[model samples]
Target: MTLRSRLPELDDATMSAEQRRVLDDILSGPRGNLDGPFLAWVHSPQLADHAQRLGAFCRYHTSLPLRLTELAILTTAAWWKSQAEWQIHAPIALKAGLSESVVEALREGRQPTFERSDEVIVHRLASVLYQHRRVDQATYDRAVEAFGEEAVVELVGVLGYYALVAMTLNVFEVRRGDEPLPFDEP
Candidate 1:
């Protein structure tokens, strides 16, 4: 697939003081660079600032563990078929201890064979939430039983935040390098 970003990256000279400040904060944060949706978000600095703060919390400070958080993010990326999101988070998920089989299954649009109960819980929560747009009682109960209420809430936040990331990447046609689309065309 040929993908080109609809939004141009903002250079320092064109950025307002606010935009520059936001960009500076992002550069210094865990993200360490303005890539992906941030390239489009820089066009609206205020929104970028707030969105980045929320994203930072969800990604860095959430109650859910990194493995669970990454799983939820990968689930969202796969559901959206968001190449940029998938490319960004897939390795992170692997490093965070997600199995290659699970990541590969997600990449290939297949149900993954999860070894851990926590992995299964997270995947189920994400899949149910993405597919149904809400968690049913059984899945909600299972998630709470596995992760507790606070972590469950944070899991949902991770899912929702990455959904926005996927949507932004999709809408703006952000491509992660020259990598081909990971999944078959719909």
Candidate 2:
């Protein structure tokens, strides 16, 4: 299926004070530009500010290791079949030390083979969370044992934040330029 953005980029000069303030903040932030959900969230400047801050924390400051965090993000992206999310984060995940094979398997919607126990926990946590909307007691115990309570909580935050981003991208039909669809449409 051909995809087009539901919300076009807003013209800066025409924006309200609140919108411009949020836009400027996003521009100066670590993200350095309005990518992913920011353009869409800009329509609601309050939401834009809050979501962008939360996104920065989830993507950058979370207690979880970058590789594990990216693993969870990719798992969430694949669960949502979000092409933009997949394209944006796949390389990041790879650079953070996730194997190309693992990224490819997640892209293919199959369980990836993980060498590390932490990787297995992260992928399982994300997968079970997406599938069941919550984890079972055993799953919870395993995650906490593997990553501790703080990282486990951050892992959930990463999964949830990326899932929200996936939904935004899906709802807005956001794409990374003229790239062809990554997943076959149903």
Candidate 3:
């Protein structure tokens, strides 16, 4: 199904000063362009500002390795069935060394067999949290054991930030174009 965005991008001429400022920040920041939920978020400039900062930290400064970080983000995207998030991150995940089989399994909603112990830990942490809304003690311990407590904290932050992104994309029906959606919509 094709879903139209509930909030269209604001024309620069119509933007309030705050919105323009946030837009400039987004354009100049690490992301370098507006896409996905940012298009919807610009409607609330303060929210766009704060959320973008948190996102930049979660996506860039987290202690987790790039591969593990992308794994966590993809896990969140799959759980949320967010096409926008999936499209943006799946290639990054593969380029960071996550196997194609793993990405395909995630897209297909299957348990992927991970060769790396760290991948297993990251996937388990995300899956348990999504399923139970909390990680089991064993899962938490495995995560902390694989990555330090600080990294574990950052992993959760990545998940939380992406979950917010997923909600925004889903609620606002954001999309790139008429391309097919990655996940089936009921």
Candidate 4:
């Protein structure tokens, strides 16, 4: 789908004082650009600030290992068929040690072959949560048992945050980057 962004990139000269402050803060942080959803979010400066903060925690401060975190993100992106999210997160998943085969399986909507028991548990939890909108007791128990309650909580937070991002990207018709679409659309 071709999408024209409803919100244009706000230049420093065009921004309100509040928008400029928020944009500058985001630029100085780990996310060094007002790219992706942030471009749209800048339309609502308060929401942009809060969402970016939450995104930072989900992306950086989470208790789950980076591999598991990226796995959850990829699963969320694939579930939503969010091209922008998939394009952004897939490389990060690989860089964080997720196997190419597993990333490909999730991208193609196939069951992945996970070498680690932890990967299996994380994938199960994320998939069940996304598909069913709630995880069954067994999956929740397995996640907690494997990763501990804290990490499980953080995993759920990641799922929720990414789901929001994926929905926003899909709704806004956010364009994908140079990377090709990861899966065939139905």
Top lDDT prediction, candidate number: 3
Query: Model 1 compared with the native: what TM-score?
Result: 0.94
Q: Which regions of candidate 2 fall more than 4 Å away from where they truly are? A: 1-4
lDDT of 3 by residue, 1-186 (tens): 233478764776889999999999999999987877888898999999999999999999999999998999889889999988898899899999999999999999999999999999999999999999989999999899889999999999999999999999988888877777899986
lDDT of 4 by residue, 1-186 (tens): 232355575676788988888888898999787556777777789988999999999999998889999999999999989888888889899999999999999988899999999999999998887778899999999988998899899999999999989888777777744556666655
CA shift of 98, model 3, Å: 0.7
Off by over 4 Å in 1: 1-4
lDDT of 2 by residue, 1-186 (tens): 223479755786678899999999998999887778787888899999999999999999988889988999899889989888888889899999999999999999988899889999888888888888889999999999987999898888888899999999889888777886678765
- Per-residue lDDT tens digits for candidate 1, residues 33-129, read 8766787787788989999999999999988888989999999999999888888899899999999999999998899999999999899888887
Candidate 4 structure lDDT: 0.85
lDDT of each: 0.87, 0.87, 0.90, 0.85
Error in Å for residue 83 of model 1? 0.6
Candidate 4 residue pairs that clash: none
1 against 3, candidate with superior TM-score: 3
List RMSD in Å for every model shown. 2.3, 2.4, 2.2, 2.5
Which candidate has the top score in TM-score?
3
> TM-score, each model?
0.94, 0.95, 0.96, 0.92
lDDT of 2 at 60: 96
Greater-lDDT candidate between 2 and 3: 3
Instruction: Mark the 10 consecutive residues where model 2 has the least summed lDDT.
Output: 1-10
TM-score, model 3 to reference: 0.96
**lDDT at residue 27 of model 3 (Cα atoms):** 90
